[model samples]
Target: MTSITIRNVPDEVHRALRIRAAMHGRSTEAEIRGILEQAAKPEGRLKLGTLLNSIARDAGGLSDAEARRFDKLRDRAPAEPMRFE
Candidate 1:
């Protein structure tokens, strides 16, 4: 196996990695290796169903007219106004 070195990592990012490793009950090196292995796999793209589901969720099941109405309302709504008394 080959060795690699990652240098000049930010303290906050390192701290985050430590926290994640602890959460997963893994050593920092093991946690990083697992993540890298998953990421390095060729079949790494988001699954089509997952992508479509996310899109459908964001779209809120609106019909064409409903979406158009929502866009119009969003565009015309006041950005800021007085709160209700």
Candidate 2:
């Protein structure tokens, strides 16, 4: 877990934060956490999985039947555990 300390916040800003926190039914700290979380890692950000899917779509997208056939062709059995004496 990581901890951050914000310094010298203006009084009016702090009061507004408190009010917003109350409106959201959360503690001021929780409100700040949610705000910071959203600011830092936004919902609309391009995720790796999403980017890969987009790329796949651009490059003649993988079809369900192709995916099913791929799965059928794979080695499904669990791998043998390594013996390191």
Which one wins on TM-score? 2
Query: Per-residue lDDT tens digits of candidate 1, residues 1-85?
Result: 7788999999999999999999999999999998998888647677554566457658887566765565566544446967998
- Candidate 1 TM-score, true structure as reference: 0.48
- lDDT values for all models: 0.78, 0.84
Off by over 4 Å in 1: 42-85
TM per candidate: 0.48, 0.70
- Give me candidate 2's TM-score against the actual structure: 0.70
1-85 per-residue lDDT for model 2 (tens digits): 6999999999999999999999999999999999999999999899665577567756877775765565578676767989999
Error of 2 at 44 (Å): 1.0
Worst 10 contiguous positions by lDDT, candidate 1: 69-78
Candidate 2 lDDT (Cα, whole model)?
A: 0.84
